[model samples]
Target: MQDTTDFEVWIEDNEPDGYEEIYTLYRSVAEREDNGIWAVTTNGDKTFVTGPTSTLQLLSEKARRTFLNAVEALKSDPEMDMESWYGYERNMANSKA
Candidate 1:
């Protein structure tokens, strides 16, 4: 596993009114599977996972530690486990077909 302690966070500006600000937490390293990028946002009460995506750069030192902690949590999440290894290969294959 990549070092989750070395990740970064980038917050988005110009967020639409009534919507919480969005942030991008990412890591730059050798790609093993998906690019080390995750989207984060809050619903005025607390932070929540907006999902994952690919990112190139814009690493922020201000949010480094916090984002890295979040990355560690995300990495351990069972929901992010590989479908094939979890016995979803047949269903996935059928869906692809």
Candidate 2:
């Protein structure tokens, strides 16, 4: 997880206009990543899932579902079970398909 400092830097870089601003920040970080794919916006009910399409396409169907659910649990579902949330991401990363 990113620290408060990293989020502060992003806010300083641009006004938090909407999901596009969030996507720009996500893209910058994603470009540096070599593995894994997942995303979510932070706009209340208007929020949506997002991420690099190419990276997501590389995932197997099961992996894609796991990754997406993991991200959602982390970013959006505060009520989700902690054990389930972390295990899903761990397995998604370890899985070959």
Q: In candidate 1, what are the lDDT values of residues 33-53, reduced to their tens digit?
A: 222243433333233333232
What do the candidate models score in CA lDDT, each in turn? 0.30, 0.35
Residue 89 lDDT in candidate 2: 48
Which window of ten consecutive residues has the lowest lDDT sum in model 1? 14-23
Models 1 onward score TM values of: 0.22, 0.24
State the lDDT at 39 in candidate 2: 47
Candidate 2 residue lDDT tens string, 7-94: 2342433333333333333443333232233343332222222333211221233433443343333332356454454455455657
Report the lDDT of model 1 for residue 71. 40
Candidate 1 clashes between residue pairs 3 or more apart in a chain or in different chains: none
Best candidate according to lDDT: 2
**Model 1 shows how many backbone clashes?**
0
Model 2 Cα RMSD, 1 decimal: 15.9
